[model samples]
Target chain A: MTNISRRDLLKSSAVTAAGATAGLTGIASASNHGKHNHSKSKRVVIVGGGIGGATAAQYLKKMDSDIDVTLIEANKNYHTCFMSNEVIGGVRPMDSIEFNYDKLAEKGIKVVFGSVINIDPDKQRVITKDNKVFSYDRAIVSPGIDFKYDEIEGYSKEVSETSIPHAWKAGPQTAMLLKQLQEMKDGGTFVIVTPPNPFRCPPGPYERASLVAAYFKKHKPNSKVVILDPKEKFSKFGLFMDGWKRHYGYGTDKSIITWIGKEAGGTVSKVDVATKTVTAEAGEFKADVLNIIPPQKAGPIAFETDLVGDLDWCSVDHKTFESTIHKNIHVIGDASIASPMPKSGYSANSQAKVCAAAIASSLNGVPMPDPSWVNTCYSIIAPKDGVSVAMVYAYKDGKIIKVKGSGGLTGPYNAEDRKREELYAHSWFNNITADIFG
Target chain B: MKQTKLILIGSALLASSTFINLAHATVIDRATILANTCAGCHGPNGISNGPLTPSIAGLPKNYISESMYDFATGKRPSTVMQRIAKGYTDADIKALSDYFSKLPKKATEPKKTNNHHGHNH
Candidate 1:
């Protein structure tokens, strides 16, 4: 059938029946539908309920409550990856970082707790694992990163689950890693293997090392935290180094943290799980608690469908974040290739707003508004020491460009300033969570 | 392709005249777009739940723009805002101020609920 004829058929049936209309709006609402209120509402289906999807869902309703928004998520409870490091550090409890969709449901968005198996762009339908299908005029995919376990020899998803916990995702793995940390004997070594570039939360591994060192300082003063990094430098590198020097006594024999960069042979070659040892160019290092954060790619759903044809991540137009490969499907968050924008929760939240605005504007048959984006990643190094990197982005030429003379790292170290940044970090947590899940 | 063409035309229109100067740009939606990016830390509509940040909602346009200018120019000693304010143009600041100045004065009190669930251990 021709595209126009199929839409006409859906519209004719939609006008006759009011009950079976919400799911049929994507097909029926293209042309005028004879003054029927149900047919006038455009349906937008959003997959994945993390920062990006949830924010898009909330903001879409906020912009036009008349548009139908449905959010499909695999897990009922969401533990934000942004602050999961704090949970692992034993500073904040796991429950504080965890949230449910009750608030979003209270708002007008339809919240479905199930895994989506397929998104048929041709048919404009998202099918869940349970065989239920949802149709939409536009679809937003915010599937966060998935690990490339095979990139690291002797490492797999099963290995990450049972033994060396990545704790990258915030749920059970976080708890598991925390348990391992607590159980390790005093003076034992805790090793962390970090991933290469283009991973979710670029500054995360360093922040993880810092907080873990802090935890050791209080609990096991003699214990050491070793970081094997694949990159020469990391996000907020100077600030992290400064914090390490002040708090952890870094660069001394008594230092609690040791970072081995790729230039110093920090790249991992294999992991001997039986011996709890990691082999790198530096040599095999045995550990009491090992963490292997493998290289990453777009979430499996992006690969399962045709969203990412030849690339590891989806290519999107910065203006609207619509997938260049597939029409009407917008990919945001870590799954999309939005360079100059780090894969932080703040970036996802920022991108979500732009995507929501674009989708809303398109559905209303109006010219899409120009977009502006902002992202600030705050890392708490110690209990009261924090640092950050921030940027404001604009759509220029054909890309999102960081505004010149704006955005920078935490300036030259002052104890009072670092403490204040810590407070701001906490405040940011409260505000962003409220913005997304509140 | 159709959407891309429209966006190009929109850019062309924006490039040709007073529209390039965002401070005087009359399209009201531009202000909202600039302001929405602030919702991450400032709370939605600039109504902050504060102990660290202030509620900028419903403030006078002059006060808001002046504060941003101060932050941008280092006249205001700030933790993060100093760096953030530098990113915006004078026109962007004007648009943000104009946007925030119109919001309601209502602010939700910072919630102090102890929502700690059980430890998995």
Candidate 2:
């Protein structure tokens, strides 16, 4: 029998702390010695180091010390797309939202900076762009969302790069959009095109408009934000409209922000890059600053791996988040078909935990437990004026469904309530990021 | 001799019951899985170090169970908990309450104060 030392006991206790301070040396020695008495070491490979991928990696190691986890991400730093809207409004610096993988590494999760070129489910191996192959007993893919630039005419990848900026990915495009909004002349029109349903962050476009309006209210008084949305109703529509009327004069002609839903010809088909104009079904609208958020589907990696079938998003067993098409592969976050759960950072984080638990149990040859999922999306309308919607879900009748009489919006809008919700929003961000990254 | 046999049987039953209790304490499977979801905000095992969220570990099982019932039934007003509570059935809530109430209480430490940027969702 292998003798366990005091240091080993300390290491084991630290694992209960969510593996935040657990050292990689302990994991290395365990694998080298094969101390767990398993027939073979179990390996888990996670693609993408975003919220879902990173959380899964950390939780997997925390749940079971014997499993080897390798996380493959294309970028060294991951900038969250969730709060990038605030960056465009000049509320936060780019570096504030950027995160490195060093903390995950400290938790004994191997972080590999490389783009995955292909995944062979039959062979249970993932090949990276640099010609490296990682074999895994189970693999998790969470590459996030990619824009379908072809959905809109006269708007291509080059156009998005040069003249217009989507700012959806929370990086250079975000910076570019900020620069344009800052440089626009007073009273100049700023047009934002909202994508269709099943997009990331259902309330994102409205929140973007609110933040931009807040900026215009402070910096450029006469400037206006015109939202051209394909969908008629949006998440928290009533609350947003109420907040707009209360804060920004929504219904008035001199209102700083104007929203044209699909009923009002808000469906944009093409963009005139030279004129800085977008042609919607209703009419042609020109803007000094054009921010067109195009339609989206699963990320490119999903396509490369054939994880997605005829549908744009990959389908998974609602209980375990395991891909229905492929065995031993799990898909989570925005890339998977998780309905009733919007594709938000919080949703991804929640899904990651459930997936992590399922993966850990499966590896241990234990029965998978009943799963529950939760999502809360809080949007800041104007600084202290915030509103939120939350829901808890459970696996029922072979599908994940929302539990009725559960989640509701922030009741009875008041200044004190809004302020508290805003504080909670910020605290939630801090808590969740620390949970996933650490 | 009959008395001795009776005593032996009694001792064996007691030992088996004790063994079962020990197994229940160490083996965390379904209950842990369900309760871990709360750790995202409540802290590990419901010992929330954060000021806004409360620590729920080691509370009376009846209190925890009743509070969850209130949230599920809309008797309690909540921002997120109401929705989360609705997901659980009465039986599930009982199991969770029982599991969390048995955890050893830990002192609440102040969460690391950091200037957090961005909206998570």
Best model per TM-score: 1
Query: lDDT per residue, candidate 1, A396-419, as tens digits?
Result: 998999999888888988787787
Q: Worst 10-residue stretch by lDDT in candidate 2 chain A?
A: A25-34
Provide chain B TM-scores across all predictions. 0.63, 0.65
DockQ leader: 1
C-alpha lDDT of all candidate models, in order: 0.82, 0.78
Report the error of model 1 at residue A395, Å: 0.4
Scoring only the A-chain of each prediction against the true A-chain gives TM-scores of: 0.93, 0.91
What ranges in model 1 sit over 4 Å off? A1-41, B1-28, B107-121
- Best candidate (score: lDDT): 1
